[model samples]
Target: MKLLIVNPNISTSVTELIEAEARRSASPGTALTLRTAPFGVAYIETRAEAAIGAYATLVELAEHHAGHDAAVIAAFGDPGLAAAREMLPIPVVGLTESALMSAAQLGGRIGIVAISRRIRAWYRETVDACGMHSRLASIRCLDEPLADIGSVQRDKGEQLVALCRAAVREDGADVLIIAGAPLAGLARQVAERIPVPIVDGVSCAVRQAELLAGLAPRRASEGSYAAPPTKACQGLPPALARLVGREGHDNENEEGNS
Candidate 1:
């Protein structure tokens, strides 16, 4: 199975971080391709960055997702995930959604340790939309300024273990999900220290992408997710206009973009 993993942020190093973790977790015969956004912020901590990141994600998907079995958006925020599902026929998985669901399966209550406090509200909204608010124990932050993927990986294990311990002990969480792309490998580092199950979204997302690649492609419903009506725009780029005017998915390529 072939999968495309899109990192919405513009950092190539972060893209490598995601790819490494994904490779470690991917099942046999699963081929993964990585794409870093050519446009957007270096990291998505605020709603404004997520907004631009989301647009870059869509454009990345359009340019790189032509022949992949499934697509995984590597960002925990899952920018453009819903829109990608609507635009493309293949199954779409987001890191945040995959982590939450995997965390749900491991235990009852779920706790999220995010990279920044700024993301708390947006992450909460996402969980609520996924209908897993009842299962959420709490969302906590590391209480530090967000750093690049490389910098965060340097000393994040200490803070991660501390937060995971608190979530399990105080927050009444049965499972803990380490949120954010930069916090990818911290789960394995702290898994032995924490009693409860700790999930890394990158690993969960890769495994889910492999599973979805083997299943029958899900068709978009005729209502809200249906293809946009053909229309002409006055000032948008020609590619953007063509994408807007494009009709429904082919639905014939069950094996992906091939």
Candidate 2:
């Protein structure tokens, strides 16, 4: 199976982090392709950025490789998830939704440890959309910048684990989710220290993507994602154009028709 994991941001570092986690989580025999938007707002720290990230995600999907069997949006906010699902025939899985679903299945109530306060609404909206709001205990913000989570020296790792424990004990959460791609590696570390299961969105997303793609027997339906736009896209990466089959003039024509 070929799965495309998309990080809807300009940061290649964030994309690499998600790709590494997906590779670790994906089942054997599965091919994981990681891609990121060539032009998008960085950090995605505010609500505006998250909203823009949604559109950026669609742009990424529109230009996705034609050979991929499935797509995973590697964002905790789950930006452009519904739109992408509607635009693509193959399975489109969102990290936040998949992680929350898995977390809910593990326990009666789940708590989400979000990356920033601005994304609390995104978390709430995800639960509401999934009809799991009743099962959601609380959404806690780490109150840290997104970039800080990726720093090895920031001590955010230890702080995140402590927050997870508090959510389980004080927030009455039976399950916890570390809800960000940058914080992907923290879940297993936190889970070891906490009593409740700690879910990582990246791992959960990859697993769900594998399961959904595996269940589908039709390989012909693969790679039917929205075609790339026709207009000239500045700074469009060469790798992206090669994967999607069109660049420059041809790309604009496809996008115009799509």
Candidate 3:
């Protein structure tokens, strides 16, 4: 199966981070493609950035391959996930929701550590939308800047482990999720230090994408996702456009094979 992973932020580094984690966890036969915003939308540290990033993601999805077997919106906030699902017939999986659900299956209760203060509401909305709010222990933010988390010497892994400990001890959480697509590589490091299972949204989303694509006997309606949007899209990277068109064609071939 083929999956398109969309990182809402414009940071190519963040995109690479998520793609690497997805590759590590993906089933051997599954094919994965990664895409990101062409313009720089830093931090996604606030509600305003999340809103704009959502629109940008939708535009990218429209211009590119909605026809993949499934799509993973690789953002903890899941910025435009709902809108993407509504716009395309294909299943859209949110990293945050997928991670939390995975955590739920591992334990009775789970806690989330968001990337920033402004995203607390987004975290709550993700839990509520996934019907896992009752299982959520708490949502905490580092209150640190995104730049700091990305720094080499910042030791985000250790800090996240400490936060997870607080969630488990003070908040009574049995499972923990180190949220955000940008922090995809930090889970293993944190899990090693923390007693409970630590979930990474990127890995969770990839596995969920694999499951959803496998469960569906057939792909989405060709008229809906197989065809690219007729409306003009601006500022889309050439490479992304090619990837979308290629995936759409591959979907047609898959249909023909069946």
Candidate 4:
């Protein structure tokens, strides 16, 4: 089965990290295609950045989404997840949603360790949307500066271990989820030290993506996610029109010309 992992941020390094973790976690016979958005900031920390990343994600998907059995959004914020799912026929899974679902299935309260404080509210909203807010113990933030802001002082592995322990001891958390693509491999790094199951969003999302890819695609009924209305999109780029499936365009001609 073919799987596409989309990292919405512009950072190719983070995408590589996610690709490695995905390969390790994915089942046999799963072919993974990892792509980082060529536009947007290195990281999506705020709502504005998330919005930009989401647009970049859609652009990337439009360019390379064909033939993929399933797609995984690698950011913990899950930018453009619903829109992507609506646009694509196959399953499109988000890292944050997958990790929370996995944590909930593993039983008991869920603890989230995020890279920054700005993402806490967004994560909380996501947890609430999943109706797992009642199972949430707490969302803790690591007080480390971004690489662009300053030298990162705290070792990610150590911080993950300590924060996970604190979540268990102080917040009464039963399962811990390290929340972001940057924290991808830290789960395995501190897995032996942490008592409970430490869920990495990247790995969890890839596993779920593989599972969803193997299943029959969802049937979009007449009312539910119905076909988009046919109309000409004026005052837009030709590529954008083709990307969104706008009317009055010859796809074969466009592809052949390109």
| Top candidate when judged by lDDT against the true structure | 1
The lowest-lDDT stretch of 10 consecutive residues in candidate 1 is: 246-255
Sum up the clashes in candidate 3. Answer: 0
Model 3 weakest 10-residue run by lDDT: 238-247
RMSD value for candidate 1: 2.4
Model 1, C-alpha of 100: deviation from truth (Å): 0.9
Residues 126-162, model 4: lDDT tens digits: 7887788999999998775676411221345567678
lDDT values of the candidates? 0.81, 0.74, 0.75, 0.79
The candidate that wins on TM-score is 1
Checking candidate 3 for backbone clashes, the offending pairs are none
Q: For residues 1-258, could you state the per-residue lDDT of candidate 2 as single tens digits?
A: 889888877778778778877888888889988878766665565667877888778777767745777889988878888777644546789888899889878999999886678878867977788888998888887775545445632456677677777888888999998887777666766566889888889999888988887787332223444443434434645544432344453444343323
* Candidate 3: residue 158 Cα off by (Å): 1.9
Query: Taking the tens digit of each residue's C-alpha lDDT, what string does model 3 give over 1-258?
Result: 889888889878788888889999999988888889765485476667888888778777766654577888888878888667645545679888899879988999898876677878867876788899899899876766555434522446566667789998999889888888768867865566888888899999899988987887454446454534434445655534433443364544354335
lDDT of model 4 at residue 239?
Answer: 51
lDDT of model 2 at residue 224? 42
